[model samples]
Target: MTRRTVRIAMNGVTGRMGYRQHLVRSILAIREQGGLDLGDGEVVWPEPVLVGRRAHALEELAERHGLTEWSTDLDAVLADDSVEIYFDAQVTSARVEAIKKAIAAGKHVYTEKPTATDVEGALDLARLARDAGIKHGVVQDKIFLPGLRKLKRLIDGGFFGEILSVRGEFGYWVFEGDWQAAQRPSWNYRAEDGGGIVVDMFPHWEYVLHELFGQVTSVTAHVRTHVPQRWDEQGKPYEATADDAAYGIFELAGGAVAQINSSWTVRVNRDELVEFQVDGTHGSAVAGLRNCRVQHRSSTPKPVWNPDLPVTESFRDQWQEIPDNQEFDNGFKAQWELFLRHVVQGAPYTWDLLAGARGVQLAELGLKSSAEGRRFDIPELTL
Candidate 1:
């Protein structure tokens, strides 16, 4: 058997998403399972060199995971001849410069989105990767989720004949951090730190809509900061300048409309923290993070409006849960394995830097729409 080892420089892995999803759940999990099999007696193994600003934290993480490589020197790691890939999960504000430097150093790049704060910067990164002739990709992890996968399957099978509309509800109440500690990082509520629901979440919505229903043609939105005051990690109080909620209506290429409501200050009243309901002429389906329930035209219940009645019928019981037919792995890990295969072998992977740039474009337009209190058209980006 032939074994191929790819050296990956993982920067900013000290952060929450970086540490849990990328480091422990993905790369380390792959390593623990004896690497990935690539058929015909070939295997691909990953060697991760954890990179972060804190040496002690990196040391501790590496030791806890039984990993040998960890460093705080990003420049040195980027310049190393043996390093095959450079990955960034740092704050969005710090990603562009680091990615540019990695491209200049002749390393393949992959990152978490929104690729940049603006569309131009995101396109520039794509152009840089294209000019350098290095493989690149961005994480669009939601598509690989089990519930969404089932939704995709139903769509593929024409279960939703002539899809009419889609509604997405995402977010949960993050504590004000006075008596209870906030679940999310404080940086998520600070504009200076690249924190805002529109930029952070609209990107996911863009891809989900385009990949499933159609390309979004225009958007109308209203964004606002619900809880202006919040406590930080050090028990310090600060003013939140970034938006906490975004209510938007998007028109799709196929003439379908999608409405998305995202908020960090809202309470959950649904089956999951995130859910999307798609309705069509033939059927309707609601997908959560891990579960999807559907009701067809034949099975959909009919109800009469009566203000005086108690309305005792169970509305939620009409839809039936979709059965799991296959084993599913962590969404982040699924994307990572595909990226590793793209690097090792000539695999068909299309989620490139350009696609990532599209996400940024959607976010930029969403902000414009919110600010103007009007609809903004989404134009195709060319690089």
Candidate 2:
């Protein structure tokens, strides 16, 4: 078998999402599986060099993972010819510049999105990547989610015939850290630090909506900062300038309205931390992060309202569970595999920098709509 090693520079993997999702669950998992099979007696293995600021932490991580290389010298790593891909999972405020540096250094670039804080920066990055003639991609892990995959399958089989509306509820209570420790980092609440629910979550929504349903034609939003202040890592109280919660109404290309609620101040009362309930003429489906349940028009329950009387019908049990017909990998890993295949075999890779820019555009417009107190039309991005 022809085995090829693709050297990659992994940046900011010390962070939670970067470490858990991108590094440990994805690239390392791929390495453990003997790399990616090309189906022609060839395999492409990934060789990653961990790059972060803290040398001691990086050394610890590298030694624990049995990684041979770790570096704080990003410029030196980027200058190396052996490194083919530059992957960034840094704070959003730090991403665009690092990505630009990678592109300029003649490396293929892949990064977490929203690629930039604003629409202009995102688009500019897309244009620069295009001009550099390097392959670029943004993380859209939701599309590869097993639950969403099943929903896509149903949509493909015409199960969701004439889809009417989609309602997505995504969020959980993020403790203020007054008593119990907060689950999320405090940086997530600061606007200057590239934090906010609208910026963080809307990117995922944009890709999910664009890939599964349709393009977002317009958006109306109401945003708020429920907790104005929160304690930081050093136990210092700080002001949170960003919106902690965002309620949005989106008009899709095909006349479907999507209502999405994202917040850190709310408690979840659903089967999953995040769930999307889709309604269509022929059938309806509710998909969580890992499971999907559907109710066909023919098998849908008929229940009459009886608020005064005791409940008789089990409404929750009416939906049929979608079976796992095949083995599914971690969502982030799945997308990484696709991207690797695209890099190695010239496979179809459409989730480019432009797609990422659209996500940032949506977030920007949503914030603008919230500020202006009116709906804003989202014209199709041209780059």
lDDT of 1: 0.93
lDDT of each: 0.93, 0.93
- Candidate 1 lDDT at 146 equals 94
Segments of candidate 1 deviating more than 4 angstroms = none
Candidate 1 local lDDT, 1-383, one digit each (tens): 88889999999899999999998999989988889888869888899999989999999999988889998888999989999999999999999999999999999998999989999999999999999999999999999999999999999999999999999999999998989999989999999999999999999998899888999999999999999999999999999999999999999998899999999989999999899999999999999889999999999888999999897989998899999899989999999999998888869888889999989998899999988888999999999
- Considering only N, C-alpha and C atoms within 3 Å, which residue pairs clash in candidate 2? none
Q: Estimate each model's TM-score.
A: 0.99, 0.99
Backbone clashes in each candidate structure, one number apiece?
0, 0
